[model samples]
Target: MIYFLRNVDDKITQTNFRKALTIGEISGNVLMDLSVMADEVIGPLLCNPENQKGWPKIVQNDMKRHVNELRNLMHQLKGEMSSQIMLPMPEGVENIYHAEARLKESDSEDVDLYLKTNIEGAIIKWAQQIYDLLQEDSYIAFKRTKFPLPISDIEFYTHRLRNLEGIYSQLRDPRVKRMAHYLESTRSVYLACFKSMLTNVVAALLREVCNLVIQQCTNSVDPMSIFQGDADEQLIKLRKAMGVLNHFIDTYEMNRDKVHTFFPPGVMPVRWSFDFDRVFMRFNTFMKRLKMIDNIVEATVEILKLEKVEFSGLRGKILSTECIKVLEEYTLIYQNLGNITYDPADPEDTRFLSDYDKHMAVLEDVDRRLASLFSQGLDECHDLEHFFKFFQIIGDLYHRPIIKNELKPKVAKLLDFMHSNLDAVKEIFDEEMAKLNPKGVERPMVDPYLPPYDMNRLNRAISWYNAIREGSHETEVALIEKEISAIDHLLGRGVEELTWNDDFTEWMAEVYAAINTLQERVLTAQNNVRRGLSNIAAWGDKPLHNRKDNPEKLELLAVNERHPRLVARRNKILQSHAEFLHILKDNYKLFFNIKEDEESDDEEEELEEVDESTMDEDERLARAQKLQAIMEQWEAKRIAREERERERAEIAQAKFERREARRLKREAKEAEKRERQARRDEG
Candidate 1:
């Protein structure tokens, strides 16, 4: 009967009958049969019945085995529903079992009740123990890494809960049923707590690892300083830190299944996410610093290349000592800087590079300026003055330390050119002087009238020499001074040597003295001639006066009659003046070789003719007046002679008449006395 009941319970639990029956009905109908069988059949048989013969040992043992089996089946069913449902028999079933128990009011009935209550108590205790174990396993799995509970542990707990569910379906007790449902609810809550604990553990571990990596990266030395020392050492430290991070990742991958058992798919904890961003950001920063160092090194190498660079012109050929020194200093600076693998990112280093570039540009500009200074030659200049000024300016520029080397040779060439020009000028001076005085004889003084033409040429040469000397002096160049002084000495010697001849000076003095004396005599003669002409003119205008009383006028006429002596005195004075003019013309001709033109001589003769004609007219008038005076005087003399002759004849005629009258008177007396002596005589 117990086997039958066990089979019936298994069938009811496996089937869907619990959906159709109420908890009270299931308890009453299903579980009451076990109690009835124990009280009516098995209990009386085991206590020894009266109407039947006494059982054998085998039959008694069989009845006891059935009773024990019934008790065990009731215990398992009670444990399934003790906390879930209240246990009660059907309305008449309990009374039927109680009447059966009364009929068998022996020790057997008491024994059955004791066993049923003991099994129910044992079922409730086991269920509570299993629930407590689940809680403990979940806590151990979450809190400790060492000896953590495996997934099988959770599986074992889930298997026990399923068995309990099956038992609860068969049980007729409300208390046991309530206990099963409560354990099921507790199991769900513990599972949720276990999943949450796992997520927290993983997230906390990730946070700790990320924090360590962040600390390592942040605590490293400055990025620029890394280039100053051993760069590999710093890189190794970074690699080690990265290795630690990689190990953590590997560990996570290895245990991915264990973590996923608690956490759902695609659900990562939020706490450790920022650490990943920090790690990547630090890595990028480190890479950028490395690139900066590379760029700085490249620029340094480029700067070092400048030591071998060559300029394109004369500046390259002539290297000044100062420029060489500057280059050496630059090389030293580059070496000092090149030894270190400095950080290009450093602002101070960047500034140094910039300054170096600028200095190099300045050097190149200086080179070009020096090259330009030597490109043109001195001969290209317009004149000596222009060339001198240009040379001075360029010389001053080249005299600087950066451009001073190799300058002396150029200056020497210029001096040689000046010497040649000076020699040429000196030769010209000597040739011109030779033209003036070929014999180079000594003289007393320079002739005033016959000044040498060579002097004018010498003046022009001196002007040229002085211009060059003055320009050279302004430059203050020592090289040109010696030549200038030599030229100056030559000029002085030429001036001092120029002189006139002694004989020529004396002859000119004598000639001048003679001309002065002749001028005085000529002036005196001219005054006397004018006075004589005036007296002759007065004599022609005046009437005749008494000869005896005007004896002074008559004396003037005698003086005027001496015209031949006045004319001879005038001609001598004029001839002396003409000789003085001829001497002057000869002196002019000797110096300048000038000849008088015939046309000019003719014009002079015409002017002389007009002057002589004026003088002749005056002289002729005076002579004509003198001749008229003389004629008037001669006429008076002739008239006086004629008058005296007429008077004598009259005297003779009167005497003869008087004598004849006397004769006639006497003839009257005597011829009248001789008849009148013939008349007187004839009469």
Candidate 2:
């Protein structure tokens, strides 16, 4: 039963292959030696060598096949392969057991040393490899991706660790007891390190989520500025980041369990640097803030859903009050943003106002759009200033005031001016109509030339006037416009309506009036005849016609042609006609002929009478304006005449001077000569 190694077999552990036989020969010799020991372990107490179940067929009925079978099974015991499927490692286990049983003491010592060294070395090396693989990017943590299944990194790595634990089961043999104990202790240490490493990775991921939140709320690179990302996008990113942070906090216990229990073998839990409670509470503030703002934003969205709306109480313009109130609530939340803190000790303490301010800016933009819908007047029924012009048109149409309060005074003032100007012109027109005053006609002798007024201001006033009044004053306005039209028509006749002339057409107006009433005697005679005809019984009878009205009273009417009263009336009519013809002849001359001699005297005496200052303030100003214009013309002509005379006189005297002028020149020359002489002497 004892197996001994010879000199050449010792060459198997030699430095040079020259001392050893060929590889096949050496393998056969080693297998023969190993089979003898296998036979000893299998004798009487164990199975027959030929019937050993796991032995290779060559080893059945031949003791050499036992070692060959064990060695053959070792082919699958390569490091990773051993980990891949660790069940039924019979070759390795039996080899360890058989080595201690039947070999010589020195040879057995050699086998013990070889198995212990190789098996222990392999176990430690594989454990290190597993740890090293976990350090690699892909294997260190289970990859999170949007793939077939949402496999969590913790579960994935935990499953892999459980599979790796299978390798430990195969090492529990007496021959490798020391190796097993060493591996067990090493595995425990590695699992502890792995747990620590895993916890660090999760913590890193938690920190990454926190960084995302910081980027959302505050500036990452800067300490002061808040992030300015888009409002809708910011809201989305914040929600997702908050979810990730919460997930880490929620599964903290489960992750530690995975590291410790059979779930992931001998992994141990490690605490993070900062307290979990503090971290949770700190980030929860952001959630609280988000919840508060969420309500405001939702309300605002509902209110802004309307394409058009109207309300008041906004300063300087009109807009929707309900929507503004919602926006104000949002603003109030932002203004009083509390529980936000920064840590100088922690560079990651970047939860600032940029994200919230950015969303607030988005809200401000909405406000600006809404503001564009406001209008100052009824005519401003559009909000093209805002980008959403078409959307705001309906709001503009409903919200604009009929006339803004500030603009009222300007319109009223200018309208009053126009009204006054019209009245002044009307008064002058009426004065011109009174063409037949017995003393003298009060004809308006206004100057033809006048100063200009501010046409731009007037035109603006007119436009504003029309914009304020919504077409309902037409009846009253039209009645008043007749006077304006009359004045305008007269002015179109070239200011002549305001000027007087010596021509008799205006004076002839009185003659024409007289001609209209020249038959005054006809009314008197008709009245006298009616009285005489009243006494029907005092008249002689005349032929009566039944159809005639009051036939019995017809005698007075029929005899009126031949009666004494009728004869007197006829004679009086002839006398009145002759007198009327004589008067017409005289008036005709006065009407057509100019009284040239009295024109200057008459105009001078009636100058004050012609002034229509008593009519109104506007008329007084008009008259004064006329006088000022005449005075300017007179002053201009006087200055021009004086300039002409001076020019002519200067031409005549250009080469000549009088005695006084010649003496003054001589004295001026003498004074200059004396002054120069005095200065030269002093020098």
TM-score of each: 0.15, 0.21
lDDT of candidate 2 over 12-41, digit per residue (tens): 655755455443223444445444444455
lDDT, candidate 1, residue 26?
Answer: 28
Per residue, candidate 1 scores C-alpha lDDT tens digits across 55-147 of: 776775565555655655565566455432212222122233443344356533333333233334444444454344334434444554556
Best by lDDT: 1
Candidate 2: stretches off by over 4 Å: 1-79, 82-128, 135-309, 313-317, 320-683
lDDT score at residue 305, model 2, on the 0-100 scale: 45
Q: What's the number of clashes in each of the models?
A: 37, 4
